[model samples]
Target chain A: MIQAVVILFSVLAIGGALALLLTRNVLYSAFFLLLTLLGVAALFVLSSADFLAVAQIMIYVGGVLVLIVFGVMLTHKTDPLNRSNQKPNAVLTNHRAWLWPVLLAGSMFAVLFQMLRQGNFVLLNRAAKYQTTVDTIGRQLMAEYLVPFEIAGVLLLVALVGAAYLAMPERN
Target chain B: METSTILIVAALLFSIGLAVVVVKRHAIVVLMGVELMLNAANLNLVAFSQYDPDRLQGQMMTLFVLVVAAAEAAVALAIVLQVYRHYRTVQLDEVNDLNN
Candidate 1:
């Protein structure tokens, strides 16, 4: 049952990423990103990282993706009252540069795949088992990883303030 | 799920993200690609954490990564918004004022 879910969500994730790549409209890309994020969240569930899964959905899908869509809408000049001429929603680009990225990413994947096939990961991971990670994670975060956890909080606060400052329009 | 299977999925995601970042012209779309790559790393971390039952280090790292990714997206989008306001376009090729 879990295997089936893993496979399904992985497919959903890969497919959504591919769709986002192929789509020209930024709005469509944002929606496709939604699919990808949700799929990743499900994969987290299958892997038994329940808290991360919930955090992924709440933070990525509920927050960042919405902000992306809003960025798309705000940046574009769309007039709701006028219907005569709508600006292009699709992004324009040079087609010639595409071959290099495909080659680069493809070679990287090929290298990683080869490494995975040859490595001793399977043997080393023999003792690992699936279990709910939330409690363990919480205790560790409050204990061993306390400093980093507090730093993360501080980083988030700084980011919030900076983002607000950067995004706010000039009064003059 | 096999460990190798999850790793392969992460590989696919990372590559697709690289492709998106490379091929997409819009800054926002490139940011999306970056998020994809970040999630790919997070998946790998969680999968490995499943193997090491003792420390749960992988899950901890994934949490930090999530926080960082959110911070990055916020600041990046704000910069992108400001860029659009000044340059009047978001395409990577055309937004080059330094080259001109």
Candidate 2:
């Protein structure tokens, strides 16, 4: 049963990424990214990382996806001469459609596949049991990972302020 | 739910993201590719953490990675918006000039 779920979610994730690659419309790609993020969250739950799964959905879907969609809508191009270009959001580039992307990414996959085929990690052989990791994660973040946790907060604050500043119309 | 199976899924995802980054011309699409790549890495970290009996170090690292990816998306999109404002287009290939 778990195996079936793993396969299903993996397919969903990979298929979503593939759809994002194939689509020309940026807005549609943003929605496809939503699919990918949701699938990854399911995979996290399957892996017994329930806390991370929730965090994934909240941060990626809630925060980042919204920001990306805004980026899409706000950055619509205005092509005056090309009246035929109906979709101003359309990104029409007719170069390197197949060769380099296939070669680079395909080669990297082949390498990782070969490496994993030989991996025999003893601990990883057992099935992961579902355990509530929120308490443990919270404790760790407050205890052992405290410095990094605080730093992450600082980084996020800086990013928020910087993004607002950069996106401000008054700057231009 | 074999570890190798999960790893293979991540590898596939990373590749797809890489392909998207390479082939897509839209700046936002490229950013989507980057997010997919980060998600694949997070999956790897979580999968490895499943077996860690001590501190769940892999998952903790994944948390930090999530933080970084969020920061990256914000900055990148802001830059993309700036690119659109100046170049009047977000088709990356068209913005190849040094100074305009």
Candidate 3:
């Protein structure tokens, strides 16, 4: 049963990513990225990382995706000479240098697959214990991982200020 | 659901992400590709976290990664917007010049 679920989401995630690559419209690609992020979150749940799953959805789907959509909209180009191409969501890209990159990605995948095939994970011999990880994560954030946790907060604050500063309109 | 299967899926996802980043000229879409790659890594971490003694370390690391990724996405989008404002186009290939 769980195997079926895993396979289903795995297909969903990979297929969504492929669609995101194949699509030409920037908005459509952003929506497909939404599909991929959700599928990854489901995989996180299957791996017993419940907290990570929730965090993935909230941060990736909720925050990042919205930001991406806004980016797509704000940066969209409307050709004044071409009347039919002025649609805001029709931000279609025409050309890409696909030959070498696809080749490199495919070769990289082949190498990783070959490497992983030869190895075995002894850790998989044990079944994962599924439990609520929120408390453990909370305690760790306040305890053992406190330093990094504080650093993460500082980093986020800096990013927030920096992004705002960068995106602000020019005073001149 | 073998661990290898999850890892393979991640590999495929990562490869597709690489293709997207390379093949797409749109700046925001490239950002999407980067996000996909990050999620692939997160999946690997979550899969292995299942085996941790207390199951705390892996997720903890993933949590940090999530925070960093969020910061990255925000800053990246901000930069993309600035690039568009300055260059009048978001296609990475078109914005070859540093100054307008």
TM-score, each model? Answer: 0.92, 0.93, 0.96
Query: Which candidate comes out best when scored by lDDT?
Result: 3
Compared with the true structure, what per-residue lDDT tens digits does model 3 show for residues A64-171?
999998888898766667766445537886548789988999999999899878777778777777777888888888889989988998999999999999999989
How well is each residue in B13-99 modelled by candidate 2, as lDDT tens digits?
999999998898888888888899999999999999988736999999999999999999999999888888888888888899978
Estimate candidate 3's alpha-carbon lDDT, on a 0 to 1 scale.
0.88
Winner on TM-score (1 vs 3): 3
Candidate that would win on TM-score: 3
A1-172 in candidate 1: lDDT tens per residue?
7677788888999999999988877888898999999999988887778899999999999889998888887777644575355555443333227789999999999998898888876545575566887788889998999999999999999999999999999789
Which 10 successive residues of model 2 chain B have the least lDDT summed? Answer: B1-10
Cα lDDT for residue A26, candidate 3: 87
Between candidates 1 and 3, the lDDT winner: 3
Provide the lDDT at A141 for model 2: 94
lDDT of each: 0.86, 0.87, 0.88
Ranking by TM-score: 3, 2, 1
Say which docking band candidate 3 falls in.
Answer: medium
Q: Model 3, residue B63: what's the lDDT?
A: 92
Off by over 4 Å in 2: A78-95, A170-172
Clashing pairs in 2: none
The order by descending lDDT is 3, 2, 1
